[model samples]
Target: MSTTTPGARIEVRGLTKRFGGFTAVDDLSFDVEPGRITGFLGPNGAGKTTTLRMVLGLVRATAGDATIGGVRYVDLPDPLRTVGAALEATNFHPGRSGRDHLRVLADAASVPTRRVDELLELTGIPAAARKRAGQYSMGMRQRLGLAAALLGDPHVLVLDEPTNGLDPEGIRWLRGFLRRLSAEGKTILVSSHLLREVEQTVDDVVIIANGRLVKAGTMADIKGSPGAVVRTSDRAALAGALRVADVTSIPGEDDTLIADTTDLRLVGDVALRAGLPVYGLEPKRADLEALFFQLTEGTNRNETAATAAPPEGDAVTAQEGANP
Candidate 1:
């Protein structure tokens, strides 16, 4: 393995991309810290791929910039040595054997030939190393792609939809591998549409929609905003009491009240003062999937609005058509 530092911070500032008149990414900004897995999450067509491409210097941004360790990808002295990227599973030449494909990359990067075999084994595809990439299964191809990414023993890893074709076991293995890498101080930025998988794997998240940032923070910081669910006799009284105490309570299922604070004792005390018997109080953790949906819903709405808007030069044409 290379003896370079294991992690580097990634910074995206006002990163924007436009395709003709349609904006694909709009001033999106977020930070991916070192020594942790940061999930780059968005629904389909939310510009997650475009943003990643911009970060990797694969796609030029119209308005902003992204950098790793304060250096743009193109400006890196030795890019592959600093950043390893696996954007797609089928990126390898189809005719080449998986081992040969890695060897080619290793040769180009000046990495030792034995490192190719080591990566094949590390990614758990040594048995199929001799198979043509065209004949490899999707899962196997993913493994090979990951092997190629790790060939340089880079400090930073950027992957897009890496779990797309993996079986449950493969996904589980990947989760563990990423965590172990993070523990070793590698900076990891993995993009996924799979919220459940990301929720389990990532330490922090940057959620975007309509090419704009929706939310960004540690998992705890995001989930910490939600409060507790309290069940009490006389739900209406409890609500009134909580309101008096300047704590808001929303009515929940099964005659329970959801308070805006996680403090169970405070909620119980308010209920006691209201002469309402507290039956139960359970912490209501915010569901990451639910929050993801909530944030992206506006993106869909904005997309619709943008799509429906008349082009700048078509205002007269639209008026003429409307009159007809």
Candidate 2:
């Protein structure tokens, strides 16, 4: 079932956020196309939540703009009916029942009460709908938060760590659910730390480091072609020979060298010409987890945050939504 408006394009241009002297997000830019699920990924304290907050108009940006359908979030006539966002799953009244929590939000958003029930069932939390929110497990709380996001039936969804507390089965169910929504022409942008899960679920990825955009593209485009790992007794000689053949090689486990090309015949010929004893040669596929670490290796902000504390305002911007 397509939404009334299908889905709107989400554009973030030069989105920057700063607190005091610390720059949380610097000149970030990306787009979430309609009918696709985009994964917003980064290391800890990489300003992901801050960016999302700015996009939702919860936190103002120091520079640039985040827009949906070419209009800023604050300017949307019916914000909830256009974009549904759940930045934090724990933002609920402790004493309120699970069902009541959604009902309350729905009422405030002018949504029909029946929509709440439908979302409750849709998110698979109806069995515990009457239980107090405080008594629910993290997984249940995640489900409740998802149900709340869908209560408006918006064409766009912005979820930060949406699968945070889900079990394997729950995660699988959510994968299918999101795919169905995308098939119905909804726009989805998910911020998550689970690289493997995001790799499987999202149609595209927007990876950042040190509050700057590093990569944004389809999975295949980013991963490129599979390279080969060659183990040899004389790595230096083999590397030199491969370099002469216009192939680059990097150090790998043991005495193995990782060649940047998938042409095994060329690698073998070069090594043989150099008289290097080859032990093992195999294809090395760069998975999402590997590529994520490779791209963000030295850009971790947590390492710095651990030793030095930022100013009061900076601290809040850096630590907000940092919970795992």
Candidate 3:
């Protein structure tokens, strides 16, 4: 095998799972790039959790394998030290304080005790550290779970729906935090159904539907196929001006002036100086979320692909959608 793998990557080859014919996940193949935040995404019951479970060895794969940093997650020495993971916020003990919860995990991972406090502050949960976890809100629990994941300072993160119930502020924080971690060369693999949020967070995305591979690529790949979309603040002038060029002005969100442009930058600049304040101008391409839903649609596609492949190899199927 030439290893046509994920390009010097973290590889998942032919992963499959079943709950006595339920086939939660099947023959999903994909790779997570090193030092990037990769979104593992799908609709409800898309096997996101089941895939994470297989990676954690919590549920054995009926076939295929997932390797982190070139080795199986379980086979890594001091698994916690090699990988940090948070599969579910509900996994935490409700009675434990945020600080104590992290402390226990730190002890288990043999991480320094001071590290717990550092993370409590790092995650903006220092005040909540003393409060009982059970009393914490969904956002608080999610933060605590993140703190626990960081206790080991692992190189790679295997997170499942990390922002599941977080508020917008919390979601924004997670995005920035994950971005910072990736900047530090940490590899993050997070599975989420929040496609728009994932579109903002992930450098690359691996989309699956009904337990199979659909599409996997950098954000650019998803949007590369999207043609030019011109935007300006003065939609009326730009729209009127664009009539001469025959580019249609469609209503786009974000106070935009949309048109199909012959020259993206050229027309964008002309429109702005023409008193149509161009806030931004570029191709309105299909982003990860759009590409995800675009590729993961058809109800039978997932089943057809799953049944076509062996239970032990990698597979990817795509469903996509457009915002407009």
Q: Under the 3 Å rule for N, CA and C atoms, how many clashes does model 2 have?
A: 0
Q: For model 1, what is the error of residue 57's alpha carbon versus the real structure, in angstroms, after optimal superposition?
A: 0.9
Q: Give lDDT for model 1.
A: 0.83
**Number of clashing residue pairs, candidate 3:** 29
- Model 3 misses residue 158 by how many Å? 1.3
For model 1, residues 139-191, the per-residue Cα lDDT tens digits are 99888888888877888999999998999999999999888888878899999
Write the candidate numbers in order of decreasing lDDT.
2, 1, 3
In what order do the candidates fall by TM-score, top score first?
Answer: 1, 2, 3
Model 1, position 309: C-alpha lDDT score: 39
Which number leads on lDDT? 2
Q: Say what the RMSD of model 3 is.
A: 9.5
Off by over 4 Å in 2: 1-5, 226-284, 306-324
Tens-digit per-residue lDDT, 187-276, candidate 3: 789888888898788899888888888788887676664445665656777878777666666667767765755468667666755666
- Per-candidate TM-score against the hidden true structure: 0.82, 0.79, 0.75
